[model samples]
Target: MIVGTAGHIDHGKTALLEALTGQAGDQRREERERGMTIDLGYRYAALTPGAPLTGFIDVPGHERFIHNMLAGAQGIDLVLLVVAADDGVMPQTREHLAIVELLGIARALVVISKCDRVEPQRVQEVQTQVSVLLAAGPYAGAAPFMVSSVTGEGIEPLRRALLAAQSEVSQRSREGGFRLAIDRAFAVAGAGIVVTGTALDGRVQLGDTLLLGKAGKPVRVRGLHAQNQPATEAHAGQRVALNISAERLQLEQVHRGDWLLAEWLHAPTQRLDIELQLLASELRAFEHFSPVHVHLGTQDVTARVALLQGEQLLPGARMFAQLLTNAPLQAVHGDRLVLRDQRAQRTLGGGRVLDPFAPARQRRSEARLAQLQALASADSLEQALPALLACDDGGLDPQRLERQFNRLRSSWQLPANAQVIATRQGPLLFTREHWQALQNSVLEGLARFHTQEPDQLGPDRDRLRRFVALALERPAFISLVDELLAANRMSSSGPWLHLPEHRIRLSDADALLWSQLQPLLVDGAFDPPWVRDLAKALSVDEAEVRVLLRKLGRLGQVHQVVRDLFYPEATIRQMAAMLLQLASDDPVVQVAAFRDVLGIGRKRSVQILEYFDRIGLTRRVGDRRQIRADNALAQSPGQ
Candidate 1:
């Protein structure tokens, strides 16, 4: 089990660890010279001959080095909150306790160090202050003890208390996959790279290949040490140093905050939708898009909070928000994250990650906010999954789900009726009922479109996707469309989708409208009028002209020059051949050359040239254009 020491700088936090473990935590010369820990330090202690070892993470207590402290705070089974008796409770002492509270560390023991410096009454006064502070916060169960590294006072009792707490600390379930949040990394003489941290979730043995992140290079564990002794295997809840083979990997690639994963889950994500808990100490309300520093398991990243439900998050208030980070983080559900000021000076607040891979769109809906709240309240994967899928109607990415919950890969179960949509990104899950609803929605949309035009093919994929209220990623939506076509529930032609029974039909009214609109469009081919202008020329309402032209365009009778402009397909093809021939001959088809070849005025020539570029018939470069025959083939009708 891991025990992290927290207190003010120069307050004997490192000294207390050294005295208990019989080794100095600060191994660096600078740390020894300054007499303070500037980074994370590790030491180990064995309470008895046969008892398991207790590892201590000695974190810097200085306000300037709080970021370093936070890195060592993750995965701590118990907290040894040290306060120097001479100084009582200092600023960093209070801040570190706040951090411990925010991180949700359940077990703690406040040690009033330097009992030798002050008299017995002075030590008693400091203990009272510490106890009073703990009583007011989440760490109220903590008991304070007075100790001195110089005199060894109360040291045995402290060890005994920690051992008792160890018995009560829960064991990490081995049911989940392996993941280690690296807190330290360095190169050794023979070893390529060594990363140290507490193993979480699953077991890893010698020669087991692990991934540094989702997309990181594969790393082979040459060896491992548990509590400073050689060990063939390491599992969740144990502190370990994995000797990574230098022959296979460069030391520079591994860094603190990178995870040594089982290669089953993808690398961490930068964005997360979380339930942010603001500190009551902060006076200013947390505003939307507010810039801050996010500290998670030794990783420090610049991020901004995008409030999901409100414009401002008041102090001490909990709100659902999205944290957009400048760098990626490997995290899962229940990972505690602290938010600090952008300057990295003050702790603004903290929060728990509700969904590491939150939907990037439509997160503000009332249903979504309610779902996030449920997720925040859920204590286990079994309780969270259904609530999550209930709000995310489009579907949840399976890889993201794996990253969000440690129990998901094994014991955590999903709904019996759920189905998977395989996409390039990952598998998306939807309940059978939801999938049926989606299929019905698609069919109804197509039926509606068919009834409106009757002379046109069904709506294209993009148009069909717009009918769904939820915004799904493009690949997942495409996968669903493909599934429907494969199942014979829908039919597809090119990029369009329709029910199998759907077909284009023309009524007498539509035929008359087409007869009136066709000649006018084809005659105005060289300088086709905009839709509104065409309606004016034909002595008809623009809406009527729009309906006729929509049918005409879908029937392959005309080309949409742009949104409002329409031209006959025949006119467009003739122009395409002219442009291609000019580029093929000269290699540089300029506007002047195009104008000369088409024999149209400058304005019409510019419009037509841009139109060709927009339609991918020609590529533009330095006032010139080149046509790639392959990509340009499908863009031009009749090509």
Candidate 2:
């Protein structure tokens, strides 16, 4: 567990750490000369052998070093909020506590350091002041533990309390991918490049390759050390130091704010959708489009706030907003971060990343804002999804759904029976209610077709597709029909598709016409003539044969390629199969080749080739053609 020290400057933060750990924090020349922490200082304390191992991040208490403190606070499990007994609460003390709250550090042990310098009564007064300040925050009623690093007074009690606070911190899940924000990076004499940060999740093993950034080159881990020990692997919530080979990478290219993780999980983006929280004590409201410095993970970058629902956010107001960053951030969804003024001098507010890789234009829309709000407040992706899919009539885009999971770094398992409707525009999401509505639409359309066209077996698959607004793609429609058929909800015979519950029986006059028409169509075979020839062959009027053939076309028995030209689907399939076979053996089969195979005239073969090209069944190259696919029988758009 990682614990951080936060309070005013020179308030015995370093001294307390040294007393507990029995070593001065980061004994560097600059720190000894200046008598203050210039950058992050790290040291570890073993409270108990059986208890969890603990590490302390002693941050600079001075106001100017707040950014440095944030760098260390990113992965700490809890904070030890320090305040000097003699001085009580000072400017930096308040700022540091506010920062701790902004960073979403819920667990803390408030300590009155330097207790030896003040009287017992003074310590009581200071403790009261600290309690009153924390009254409205997450640590309300958390009693301050008085301690003096100068002597051993209250030292043992503080250690016990720190252990208890650390126990309360829930461990980060050790699943998914690993991400480490590089807080410290430099080159050692002969060990190559060393970078240190807390591993947020998963494990990073020695010799494993990790992507440097989004679309970044791969880097191999030459060696690794976790929790100050030479270890083979590291897991979540542990301080890790990685030794990377410096053959191709430059020192300047490795810096704070860059992230190391699996390539698929690296979604570096500039725009973010957030659920913002403004501090109630701020003097003014959070104005829209106001430039601010976003302290995310270990990196601080300039960004502007875009109020998603309104023009401004009043003090203490919680709302949905967008952060437009000047530089890319490696933050994921649900990562807590603070927002400061553009100059990096004041804390404006803080928020959680909702959509870290959000699109710019879509985020500004009102419809999207509602979805963002629902997702922001959800406890899990499963809880947020239904409302998210309900935002648009069209199903949710896969890319949009990924933002929620990627933002939270969640497991990507989808729920059962997750309804998805494929459309020409894209995949449209459907609720259970909507799926039911679709089933009704199909059954009702078929019933109406039966009522209107009594002589036909069912509606043409193409006609039913149009009647339903053509919302589903052809493939999706066919899949739905197949599913219905498997369930015995629908049935099909030859060219006809129909509900299993419905049937068509021919009338006396229609029966006589069908008997003659069926024979005429069968005798014509592969080279079936037009309606004119059918009427002459059957000794019927041309207009009457044309009307009867149209009825046959509705039954799915015949296919009409052009005006006055019709053939049974069986004949077309036979001709298509032969053409495909010829193209497979030959380089390219032209109309002449197909004419010879079908033993048909030039006009008929040319018409068939042109039809094949239009429907994506064949590709034309100069005077020759080739088969595009082998699915000529499944060419119904309505299917």
Candidate 3:
């Protein structure tokens, strides 16, 4: 268990830590000379013999160094809120208490220091003041311990209470990838570089490779110490110092607020959707787009709050908002954050991160708001997923879903109503209702199109996508189409997509004209005649021949290689087979070779190859084309 000290400056916080640990707390030269802690100080000791070590973080109580105090406050199990009996409930004391409350640190032990210097009545007065302060916060029932650091009065009892509280400190869940917020970094003799911080989640073993900072520079852990004791590995909720090394890493490149993370947990973002509360202490309302200092983990960055609910947030009220930071911040769901004024002078309030990957636009939409509300009310992804999927129509990316929740795929408690559809991008998660609705929408859409235009077969994939009138990603929609085709619920011919039951046939007059046209197209199968030439040979109007051929093209009876040019569907299939044979020798099918195989002119070969490219049969790269393995034509001519 880690305990942090919080109080006004010169309240003997560091001195109290020294008394408890039997070790000097103010080890810095400046701190010893000034008789105050200028920065965060640390001490570790087993309060009772054979008991687990209890780490102590003695934070500077000066208002100017509140940022330093906040750095040490994160990941602590309990807080020792020290109040000097001689100066009861000072300004920094109140601010520190408010910070602890905002940080959601529920366990606190109030300590009234310098009791020997004050009379019993004065000590009682300080306790009453502390009680009133705790009454409105999470530490309401915490009893105060009176002690004089100089005399060691009541010291033994305070140590006993700390041991008792340590038993009640629940262990942090070790379900996420390892992450440590770096607060101090330096070089040690014979060691390349070392970084110390509280391990926020997961575990790290000796020789484990971890990514460092937002740049994700890879580093190997050479050694580690957990809770100030050398160990082979360290897990969450322990103060740890890692001896890390990389080829390019230097002490200058690392600083406070940088993170040591597992490879899968290295995503850093500039925007965070959060549930914020305005402190009742604020005299004025917090306006939209208000600039403030955002403190999460051990990092402090300047950010502007974009209010999601209203133009202004009243003091003492809670609201959801998005924070747009000037620099990237590494955060995950449920991570606590504090907001100070833009000047970084005073604590305004704090909040919990709801979504680290916040959308830049439409964040105020009803659907988005509902999703945020769901995320706010739930503690885990499993609890919030039902409402989230209900509001999100596009379905969730399984990769992002797992990453957002900081859990591995094996640990996810996926809902039974959820469906996973495989796409080239990754697996997409959709509620069964939403998935069925998408499939039905496609079928119903094709049926409606057939009814409206009985002469036309159906729209192509791109046109069908637009016709559906729903916002689905292209990859996911392609996956949906493939699934339907595999299930025999929908079918595609050439470039057109339609329901299996929908079909278009040539009218009798057009059919008769098509019969006369088929002979001309098949006679020179490799180099079909243009519509104007066919019409001239048949002694018919060029416009009529063009209309008849276009109708045939729609019914998959003919291929329109180019404007006014048509080929018999069988001839096109034969040409595709020839190209595939050429591609077998070398995947790159050049135009010269294709033209030679078809015994056609250069222009005719280029046109036919371009048509093949258009239908996803082949992809053209420069002057050569590569056959697409997934193309049905490549698999077999009958397809």
Candidate 4:
């Protein structure tokens, strides 16, 4: 079970956790002298005697470092809210309670610490104040106790209360994808760079390559330790210390905001969607589009809020809003957040993240606002997937999708042809239908180009690339085109592409000229005849003969042997089949015999044989031709 300590500054939070766990939480020298925590500190406790697995997260109580406190509170199972008996329910105490409430922490035991400093009557008065405060927050009706780490007055009762809380806590499983928010980074003498944090989900072993967010750099785990002892693997709900093998990383290079992830997750974005609520005690004069400090998962960003409902919100009222940040942040859906007013620098309220990577939208658009609200309320992946798909404008990045649905990816059951492709700009999600439509459009574009330019073989690759890029305007356009070719819907020759289903239909005059050109192709030469010669021989116009040659080239029915000469499809196919069959029987056939067998001169035979090699029909030995073992002719037709 995992436990968390929460209270205002200098309220004996770290002291109580230390006394209960036998571990000192304050690592920095300043925190020990100042008597206030400035950063998050972690320690472990064993509620059950000789138990193997039990821990607690000791969080800072300072209002300024509440962002650090939030990072520690994300994966906690039980709360040990330490309230001093002398000063009950202070400002930071109320803010921390609001954060826990927004984060959905249900079970808690309120500890009124430092009871020895106050008189008995004063302690009772503080208890009454604490009870009133708890009645209105998430800790309403929770059990309250008094404890003092100095005198050990109520330690036994507090221990019993913690043990009872441990019994009611459930175990956390490590079945999802790994996500470790790095709160501390340092270097060990012998071991390389080391990072310590609590694993949010899934497990990490001693040797696993992990991708850090935004940077996307791969780092290997050299070792793992849990509770100061070497361990093979660390799972969710366990505080972990990892020794990384990256030598170039400095201690200051990695900060409290980076994430160590299992797979490449989403790129950090500057805008987000959230369901915000204002605290009842906050002033109602705060406007709707006010600037505030946004805190989530150890990241603090400055953002302006735009309310989804009325012009201004009343205290204790909930409303949907968008946060436009000043910088990028690494966040995910369902993460809790705290918003503090910028002018006064006081925490206004808190809320849960709905869309951590949303795009900016204009205000006063009712339809889009309603859509965002629906996305926030979606309870399952089935509901969320379709809503995300509808909002995706065809250019959602694959890495972002993997992170957002890492836990539910297996359940999505995307088809084989469906793919998430990444390009230089971003990622795009495509299904079989989208690929088919793209192929059809490319084929039609090629056909149009062939009709207009009779001299060219086909549309060049640049033309096709540009056409698709302009038509789709998606970041994954190049990747999608590559997928289309891999699936055999399109084929490439030289620098041109052709759709497998597109064929060139010929007119009567062109058919006549094609018949005349077929016999002359047997005698391949650099310059055969001009268009006028072909027209004079076939009794047709020169323009018609030119059109015939162009049509044949586009359909792969003919290839330009030289500047003016052309070879017909029938001659090429017959020679290709003979060469394939001969190479299959004799592993080594001389180049001279290959030329003689095809009934063509050396030049044309070499070109046709090289083409066969490229099509995977044959292999080239030392100055000879040999058939590939896995060639199409080597397999039976049924295959």
Q: Model 4: which residue pairs collide?
A: none
The best-first sequence of candidates by TM-score reads 3, 1, 2, 4
Using lDDT as the measure, which candidate wins? 3
Which residue pairs does candidate 1 place in steric collision? 71-298, 192-246, 214-267, 454-505
Q: For candidate 1, lDDT tens digit of each residue in 1-639?
A: 789999998899888887787886547999878877899988887876678889889999889999889989988989999999999988998899889989988888889999999999998899888888788787785678889988899888998888888889999877667888899888788656789998867889999888885456788899899877899998888898999873456777788888888777655687798889888878899899999999887678999999998899898888889999998887788888999998999998999998887768677888788778878989787787777677767687766667678655556577777677777666888877887787777777777877875767766665667765435676777677777878998885433467788766667887887787778777775777788987887788899888777776775556676677788767878788787777768977888988888777877788887877764566789777887453323344345
Question: For residues 222-249, what per-residue lDDT tens digits would candidate 4 score against the true structure?
Answer: 8998755689998877778888766566
Which ranges in model 3 have alpha carbons more than 4 Å from their true place? Answer: 519-528, 558-562, 566-638
Per-candidate TM-score against the hidden true structure: 0.76, 0.71, 0.91, 0.65
- Per-prediction backbone clash count: 4, 5, 0, 0
lDDT of 2 by residue, 1-639 (tens): 898999989898988888877878685798889998878998876886766568888898777888998898888888988999999899888888888898788788889988889899999999999998899899999888889998878888988887776777788877656789888888998887888898886788998888774446688898898888888899889999999873578778888877888656766788888999998879999998999999988989998899887898999899888888988887766788999888898887898888776767666677788778777878666777777766643455555555436433245544464576654445545676766666777877877777876777775455666666645556556555655666788787644677776665556776797787776666787677788887888788999877766766766667677777887767767777788678668958878889998888998888888876765567889878877542324343222
Give candidate 3's total backbone clashes: 0
Q: Candidate 3 overall Cα lDDT vs. reference?
A: 0.90
**TM-score: which candidate is best?**
3
lDDT of 4 at 251: 69
TM-score of 4: 0.65
By summed lDDT, the worst window of 10 consecutive residues in model 2 runs over: 630-639
lDDT per residue as tens, model 3, 513-572: 888888988997787788889999999999999998888888777888889989887887
